[model samples]
Target: MIEVSKGIYWVGAIDWEIRDFHGYATPKGTTYNAYLIVDEKVALVDTVKEPFRDELLSRVGEIVDPAKIDYVIVNHLERDHFGSFAQVMDVAKNAKVYASGRGKKGIEEVYGERWDVTAVKTGDTLGLGKRTLRFVETPMLHWPDSMFTYVEPDRVLISSDAFGQHVAGSQRFDREADPHALMEDAKTYYANILMPFGTLIQGLLAKVPSLNLAPEIIAPDHGLIWTKPGTIIDAYGRWSKFEARDKVVIAYDTMWESTGKMAHLIARGAIDGGVEVKLFHLRKSPYSEAVTEIQDAKAFIIGSPTLNNGLFPTVGGFLYYLKGLKPKHKIATAFGSYGWMGGAVKEIVARLKEMELELAEPALDLRYPVTKQQEQECIEFGRKIAKQVKEAKQ
Candidate 1:
């Protein structure tokens, strides 16, 4: 945890979660987040999970007298929110804990320890000396315990997890590092981390707009703080809308590299036309993650050499995942390295149809040991997509 602003600091844990990169079904390296405050009356916004309770306390101790902290506001009750709850109060005995009415119930379930917890509803306001914090109940903004706390005067939004990336580090603000990687991480965070609550997210977007609240800085519980504000808010709005990128996502599962050759050719063409592309070898990529990469691509293309009388088994899995996502504003095509058994291309095309992807004209399917003509066809396919990309942009 590090301080990013005067009287403000990040108390979140770096994701050292084992296999975090692989994902949740597997061992997920997750960021256990928390925050601290130093106002006229010191307060701590949230606490880390239990394993880092002591660390949370020490961080809070860095600025002021923990005992003098007037409040410990609980944002959400996933142990991540209150794992350090007890230890924090152990140090700040006289502090008042604030949370939503339902959020308080959650805190109590594990709060077995005694403490002063005040439950407030929407529109509740807390006076923290020179600054005022407004609590906005954002139920199901991913979780029931979820809420958005806005600190007026400073124009800071202490959002727990929202607009946050699953970044692992002690860097408190984004300006300190590379913006591109962090932004991608933030996008992946939205697509994968917050995927399940789309409707609620849309509602939050509508509601927050009515508040006319645009923070100059958005301080989330995880990842770097947004000192430049709209950089992340704009991103959140675009991502939540499932905006499509003018790029192609190439997913392929090749039996003997023939289908892979076709995929490479198509990618070259798309790149030549200035369409960005992400190539994921299905055998080497997880279906769940591939779906994420495909989420916003302007086009999706899959290739699989015939196997078991149909598309490769992995290609089928990827298709199923894509179908569940029901992506929008995308074109789809099928290509493959087929031998005597050329059914894979047809099967993939049919599956893509089931996913509701608008078909791009003339799906390409190549036979084993492509001749010069086949490679040229691949380049043509790329060039076609590139043209479409530019036309779409226009």
Candidate 2:
């Protein structure tokens, strides 16, 4: 067990083999992190998934008996974080449960009211002799019941899900992990899970500074803890604002080689026009990974071949996922190939429009095998888009 503070130990389990999390790919696995603080009243920050309850209990047992636990904090009511709450309370029967008002209601809705949970609001503090535990409500920072627990004296914020990554490893802090990979996972997490709540995140960030809570460390529910809180706080500020770079992402799926060839030619034109680009075959690449690329890109170009009267199933799935993510301040366009009925490009265009992205151009479609003239047209279309991206106001 890693000691984050003098009296606080990380008592969480790492899922080394989990390949997927809530439908998102978790190739690197993840950690269901919880913290144990030994003060006048022993407090548990959070708990693990239901399957990992034994692991959490074992870790907590190393420092103190489970019966000694006096308080259990529920930062978020999601199953991943709250699945083992019942088990913890069952063992530490004397421990009083604490959660935000909404969190308490959500927990009751899911697990019934066998145990009495004290509902707290923003700015509420619980004294534990030497240190103070303060609650901050963060609704829709991914979930309505999400809240942050600030442990004073230690100056640590037990941030629930915010500023977290799906990384399972021996390291317990961001400094111990590969910074590049950790940041990449953090970006992917933000893109897939938290992008839709951009406004709420921004509001949370602005609210934190005014509270004057200078957190020295940020302990999140997943991934390594952030010892240097400034790094992640700065990142959240930028990401919450939907700040993007001068890059384009071209995502597409192909049946034969027609649509694939167009994707390559278009990528080539964008490169020749001095615009940074990322190209991914949706079926080959994880949709979550593509969403990560799209997060900070100024433009997205989609290509798919028509199947029956609609988009390719893989393409449709990717678009559906991307649309739900609600990427903002992006320009989009579509290109595809069809055999008899040309409908894929139109459908892709409509999906991008539904996402509220600025339509960079009308959809481009080709019948059967793409001709040399059509390839050239695709190239010009890419160049035109590059010009638009270059001229876009930062």
Candidate 3:
């Protein structure tokens, strides 16, 4: 409940263990972020998780009488952002709840009609004495009603979750964290959550810049606030453009030791070729986690062992979900082990194409037990991917 700036307060979870988020099956702890802006008119940007309701109330009290708060801006309809709305009403009964048209029903479905819920459109402004919050509708940002709130005087943008990560901590700003840790945290968040919405993100980035509004603070619903402003703007520009990394995501679903061996050496080949690599055993790694890690990589390689005359169900499921999001602008390849029913390779290749990734080469499909020849093929595949990444200068 501490104030992060003159009149801005941090009211989000600071859990160190929440690595996963969005009900997306994350392996990392996540924060349900909220903010309180005390100005000519008191405005609260979203609310915390249910248990944190009292804390939110206490914080608002510190700024002024809760009843003095003129508006409660609902940036995202997800429960993590509005779970405490009921509690808030008890204090600020007259406060109006602002949300996009798409979010109103979601909130109604969750909380029912209990207060003034105004469904606004893009570019709607709410003036509260000296402060004005302009709302921007950004649908399909993982949700139909996701929105961004811009505070005029402070030049603060409450970008619900657009540039946010699932980083867990009490650190309010990235400047306080280790740079490497912050990068990983931010990267993972973008990959897992924002990857599927790449096109929408790109559009939003362009739209915001044209608005010519420079935000000194980008207070997202999760992770650190962008106090440096351009820091995250630059990051969003790079990530939304699918900026390539000198890395590859070697995501696999292995059976027996055959496919496992291939994944290990392929990663080695990539490393030897001077490319960074991340290996995620699909069975052990959640798709959300892998997606986040894959976001910045210049290339993607998926390996799976054949089962039931088809690709492993998990691998198939991941592709189906990822396809819906339409991740693109990267080179991709496939590799895996098979027995009599050698269908994994074809299935993987098809899935990669489904995501519209630029095909690299014919998949290196291996037969079971991985003959010495097949193992060497895995190494060559890694080398090829490395060379491709290096050549791409990602």
Score each candidate by Cα lDDT.
0.76, 0.89, 0.79
Give one digit per residue, the lDDT tens place, for model 1 in 215-272.
8888887667888877877777676666777878899998788888888999998898
- Report how far residue 385 has shifted in candidate 3, in Å: 2.7
lDDT digits (tens) for residues 219-338 of candidate 2: 999998999888888887788777888888999999998999999999988887789999999888889888899899888899999999889998999999988988888888999989
Clashing pairs in 3: 18-28, 18-29, 18-30, 19-28, 19-29, 20-26, 20-28, 192-292
> Per-residue lDDT of 1-394 in model 3, one digit per residue for the tens?
5666677777666555654454466455667678888877778889887777876777677667788878898888677777787788778878888999988888788778977799988778888767778888889886898888888877888899777877666577878878787777777777767777777777877887676567888888877877787866788778877787788898888768688899998998898889999998888878876776677788889888899888888788777766765666788988888888699889999878767788889788877787777777778889889999889844
Better of 1 and 2 by lDDT: 2
Candidate ranking under TM-score, highest first, comes to: 2, 3, 1
What TM-scores do the predictions have?
0.79, 0.98, 0.90
Query: For residue 178, what is the lDDT in candidate 1?
Result: 90
- Once model 2 is optimally superposed onto the true structure by TM-score, how far is the C-alpha of residue 270 displaced, in angstroms? 0.7
Q: What stretches of model 2 exceed 4 Å from their correct place?
A: none
**Residue ranges of candidate 1 with Cα displaced over 4 Å:** 1-5, 16-33, 65-70, 79-96, 105-119, 194-206, 242-245, 272-274, 283-296, 309-326, 337-355, 365-373
Candidate 2 colliding pairs? none
Q: What's the lDDT for candidate 3? A: 0.79
Best-to-worst lDDT order: 2, 3, 1
